[model samples]
Target: MAYFLSSHITSTLWKLKPLALKTTCVGSVLAVNQRKYSSKDDAGSEYLHRSIVPTMHYQKSLPRLPVPKLEDTIRRYLAAQRPLLDDENYSNTVKLAHDFQNGIGKQLHEELVAQDKMNKHTSYISAPWFDMYLSARESVVLNFNPFMSFNPDPKPEYNDQLIRATNIVCSAVRFMKTLRAGLLEPEVFHLNPAKSNTDSFKKFIRWVPSSVSWFGAYMVNAYPLDMSQYFRLFNSTRIPKPKTDELCTHQKGNHLLVMKRGNMYVFDVVDRDGNLVKPTEILSHLKYILADPTPAPVCPVGVLTSENRDVWAGLREKLLEAGNREAVQIVDSALFCLCLDEEEMRDHIHISHNMLHGDGCNRWYDKSFSLILSKDGQAAINFEHSWGDGVAVLRFQNEVFKDTTERPLVGPTTPPAPIDSASAVQRLEFKLSPDLEHGIAKAKENFQAAVSKLTIHAMEFKRGGKEQLKKKKLSPDAIAQLAFQMGFLRQYGKTVATYESCSTAAFKHGRTETIRPATTYTQRCAQAFVQQLGQHSVEQLQGMLDACSKYHGQLTKEAAMGQGFDRHLFAMRYLSNSKGMEMPNLYQDPAYTAINHNILSTSTLTSPAVSLGGFAPVVPDGFGVGYGVHDDWIGCNVSSYPTRNVHEFLQCVQKSLEDIFTVIDGKPIKSS
Candidate 1:
């Protein structure tokens, strides 16, 4: 006989399965650190006074992240998988699900419930989730990680590389200051404000779970890779350097490492008082490095990080052993890395090439974030996914862009107090052994081989985006998601299971939830648009549109409530392993594999603040669509391999949106 547990335990497990757990954010590194002081006053002015500040002060007050009901989670899971399976397979899955729920499922759920109740850690899932993000996968860095590019800031007239870099430094410092001071407000789910609270708010700054001892069980702590390890961000190579236990301590130092022409320079970003030095002071050091003539061939050493994680880790051990302790310390201890790239970025393709894997040299890919500035002043950020999701970084980008645009800085007119220019910049030296040389050669071969296979296409859909969608009384996100689904169906001539990330930040420590966009409604909508064409009536088009919108909204709500299928199923599977249970037949069923294999992997980040966002496809034949939906325009970064035509797909997506707009407006569809 099984012991019946309280509902709270099941609910806790539900909450624990939130999709946002997989999302990451830049923690305290934006740079300022302060102690919490005042609480909110009745008028809300105290919070309002600090404008656009990112802080963790509200974390303690936020409600704990909640879990959804077990039954609800299972129901949503079946529904999500329903569209992808045939009747026989799906019916078998239904029986398996029922058997588990009635028999062993109850036991497993109870164990999880007990675990959640007794687990005093920051979050039960944070550590395991992070471990999978970091050490689990063989592919590390950019392939599995996602990145975004900032179009050149127009306000700052930084034709000179050093001056533009300085402006960026200052803006970054200001953003960090806000984050450190805990001034930035946390993001809330506007659709359900009631669910927004402190624990969720705390996730913004909570990199790794801080107090595992509270759980009385040894739960791995998921530290925010960005905040807790800010100083470590520079010498940071995802590659494990030798004497790392000792060298990691150097990351606490307050300096920024500069990688330029073929040399590495160390410079102080923080002054004696611990405040970031002024932009002019930083420019002085950059100027000194810029003056170096006849620089050596830039070390191809950074390429080791771009290799397969296991391969890089093995190579890093050798590289660290070969280099002097001091050199390793200098590389590791610097606060963050700044690359002074001399490449002229003429277009997005150039930007993608240089930023993703810059000539295999001028970059240390393991750093939490690498700020790469082209000679032409165009900038792109190559970030490590282990740090956090694109949301936090998006917030970081928005803040910096706003700072630069609002107050454009002309070149500094006055020189700073006389200081030895030589003292400001120190070059890091690495004495390579034959072993190190061989490792470097192998890493380069692997890096180039991987780079050759990717096909990336970046384009802007100027026809219509948020504004036109709103005019049609449609949700921009839902419609945009449909456009991609329609586009994929049109291109491949068949519908496949899709993954769309929807934020559950409203819940405590919420990350993301999967909204399967390839649903019955989506299929109907696509079929109508593709087949009916010029013959469709306005009423029929509206009906299809309404069905698609309704389904999208329903999934979004379920995801926000932690009732989406993916994470819950994942959590159930994870918990089974933890409890030493046998393999569940539900997971092994073909129906399970069908839905889990996402062929249309897409995400929408509709912000005017960010120009481009992208990620690799979850599957080889799939396309990764990271789109930004602005009022009148849509910026899309479509990523895939040689098997798919990303360029033609983008055109199809744009045309699909146009077709939908015309059909919805009661106009006849014009043949493309």
Candidate 2:
């Protein structure tokens, strides 16, 4: 359970980075020129002269992530505890924090700083962050991987499974080609694109040395994020070991892995000379795999990936010993995995369940990522969390969505190329012993039990959103978070610990820092809205809203700047454990335990391409909240285990938002 919590805590932490790039005519122009140049030049030389500044030009000069001051971290920690702890408990916790700050914590902090200084190329959190994910021994299914679904194509005709899958595959290959060639645009947050994200700025920055290029971009209000994780976007899988896992990448492998009805197939999507196969040829192979009449395997090997990590590692060794080494190698080395589901999605809730964690037979959960498509053409990317965060995945999704929708390489009427797909695609078969087959059946049973215990519910608030909140001179995110607080209070009548992720991507190889949203201000504001709505004056309630908004905004800024207390304390505790030191009194306190078990684990991302995203709860009693504050509406997709009522919780959330909007509109709060 702790492993599951840790996976989501770190997984949601990095989704706050804004990686969506603007679609412009200039980009379209560049794409056209790139396609023309590819046709004329050698494959390697095609993108060499396309971009004035290469994709990774600013990586060397990005600033290093900073460690927060010890006193500041302690101060923030105590403040976060104020809302959740009683007076006596808070006092005891404060004393423990004080003693720890002066005693062993100082030594651990010094050691951590020394370690950070020695590793200058990477951020302080990089190695430990990787270790945290790789060392977890739980199944990756609901514990680690998450899904972000793409919106349906505008042209209804293109939504046919075959056409949509083909376009996605082709566009994905094009994205990979552009990224590897250094022609894809760098991931940047432009405060003023007119001045910073311009061709003139690129022409000037191209002359600067790579080591100092980041400064030039920074001077113009453009922030370039670390791209180190992008390398793992392709040809990578998480290999289960006895107590840990390893991220393996086989860059030389050019084949794509496709799964249907529990069977696996692979075919080369890249030609021998290192160029993408024609879209028609790729479509023919995918169509052939879809048309294959193989029955679903009675013992699906893919379900083994959903077992406990150690258990899976043992089963994997047995599989290799049973003369299945070649088949396993093919799976591990494939560029990426694609699942073709037979059922059409009924709606958003159904889509969430299917994409988040499927029946466990058609998905290879250990792959770096898998692109799943339903028979009716709904699509989503369910990615393993160990390799990277949403930055790389979202960028890839944004580009593919744009390319496939705006300039599809294949359409509904396009005919599959006349090629012998039977020879091109290879069906992967594993030699399973009786023991292995029994293990697989057990895995399937366990997976079914796990997924069956989960529930998902979604809601949309149409009364107001980012536009409305901004018009009221309030932070939309703060307001969205405030609704969660009020919703929890309305449902359970108390404020618990909450976590919202904020990215620190401006720094080199940066991960994420936690934004503790269950502050004293929000607690006060939630009480006014939920319990004392009719008693308080409209102005007074509005004032509390302003206070909540202000405090939350400040917390967000601090977390984004990597000054939050969560990661600092987390790293120190991890260090203490690693060094075999005694656990600090502060860490042993019940308050510490309570804060780490976040009941409302929330993350927000808004993109044109992503319809919605979701993850299962980190704890059995918690709610995993994924939301987006759009222009005129705010949407939430939440998940929970049987310990909580997800449906009723969403109802409370809707009412909370309505009450908030009523107050924001300078009207009296209405009682439910």
Candidate 3:
């Protein structure tokens, strides 16, 4: 069965998913191993005393969402998100999702689809964190639209071997469709809702059963939405009849399809609409996405313009020249673009239907791309990140240069530079909180309670869980179980809290966030991912279960509700993890959008860098997401670690469903 998270958890996970890596990277490379300290009475006082000091990296870019309208849009948008799972929309869903894999993914997949395809340099690295935003209201649409209602979540794709199958692949696909519908364009890029009884699209995608021991699964999907309905949603998100002429209104801004950043997209409704009052800016957004921009600055494939080449080669040597002293902090990197945009000739790429976002997506976008064009002297550029990694950026720049007189995208063409705010500039007094102190104390109490006197005696220092998993062909669900129990066994404290939070700065536009009762939410995920191990070895399962049960039970209830461990109350914590505080805040004092425990670019990975190519989104938990180097393998791959702790709350999730086969077949080979 596919276990959906609790309401609070679902929302929290969704929001946290986006900022997972970025937020955690704050205030100097956030140390993953940093110990949680309990706060004294001073925690709240410190927060209260900390006034709104401003910063520059991101100004009060957060304007109030037209309150009354925002509320209405949120309600309507959420209601439209649900799809009937029993119908054939299922096949259509797969067909749509598959487009991502086949079209955009094909570029990366063809190269890294098989292990042998990877050359020596096929390693994945963590790039720095950046904040991109969107503001919505409904004069752009009328009622609330689902995509803009809640903040999108961070999604991670692991290259680990598939172990268990808690939810059927169909469920996973459906969940993906649901997430896609909730985040981006639904109808075109997604499965057509149950319509005719004979849509063959439903028969295309198949679900994997819980049999495999080691499997590899990767999905990069983009769903579509009805253009008119979407436009209605868009209009609602904007301020109606501005008392004064405000907003980045286009005087010279002729409507052209444009994607702001490399990954997120934009479509001009005027161009496609044929007639328009105010040109609509379609932010073809991605929640957990992978894209490739085929037309501008990076497409027409392979060839790079002189200026673009200079930019790439120039950065390679860290040119001492004045004008370009490293826009992105990383000392080593490359940029290229994928030829995925087909908006001009056809609305969609050949892969699947989920190729565009928002309105005008299915009708025209499915056949053509949201092409960037110019009427005035200025030209517009657009593309998807699914083509390749950050390197693809330079490739796109080169394409844009081809049209410019410079022939090389030098002067005005340089896109925004990358920034790593591990060190936000707010000079402030730092103090610990009572909750922090209590959390630390509770963790210890639970640990002590969970580890029965016999655990120490019976536990072997290292019987080799990794080795065992390999041979047993453990599933992802199985790994979650092992991690839950094993992590506890190896942990210094009893209660292992899943660190979950988001970068408040990332989505200044939307006020809704998902994580509530952080403690219970995590505990349940721990149980769900862990307890399912019951299907495996009863002895190991019971032993681990008893320990967690006892730890949670004795750790609270009878224990005086004092000195930390409490079964009832839990608190939400926040930390100013943004480093952009050095600059001045225009509205408030040098204020900054504080990023709390976000996943900044890290120097780590959950597993050893494999040769398989393709991008992986930021995952929920396993390896702690924080700022570090790409070369550093901290929490590199989820498949490498056991997932027990997370599974406890999530209901045992296996690594790769394919891995389950080895276990059931009786001759399980070691994972290593």
Best by TM-score: 2
Once superposed on the true structure, which residue ranges of model 3 sit more than 4 Å away at CA?
A: 1-672
Clashes of each: 32, 0, 179
Q: Who wins the lDDT comparison?
A: 2
Tens digit per residue, CA lDDT, model 2, 21-138 = 2110001112111121223333332122245568899899888888888889999999999999999999999999988889888888888899899999998888888888999998
- Who is ahead in TM-score, 2 or 3? 2
Candidate 2 or 1, higher TM-score: 2
Higher-ranked by TM-score: 1 or 3:
1
TM-score of each: 0.82, 0.94, 0.22
lDDT per residue, candidate 1, 1-672, as tens digits?
Answer: 000000000011232232222222221212111112225422121112143223443333333344556677677777776766678877988888777777766676677667667754334444445454565444554456565667666655554566677766666655555455555544322112222233343343344332321121111211121122223333344445232211233435677777886567887777777576765667777778877774655346666667766666676677667756676566666666789888788888777767766666677766666777888887767776554445455556665665556553437464643667687778777877887778778877777777677778887877777777778767676787788878887887777888876544434454445778788888878877876576667678877887787777667656645557676667677888767878888777777787777777776553334455566676777777766667787777777878789989998888888887777677767877
Name the TM-score of candidate 2: 0.94
Candidate 3: global Cα-lDDT? 0.20
TM-score sort, best first = 2, 1, 3
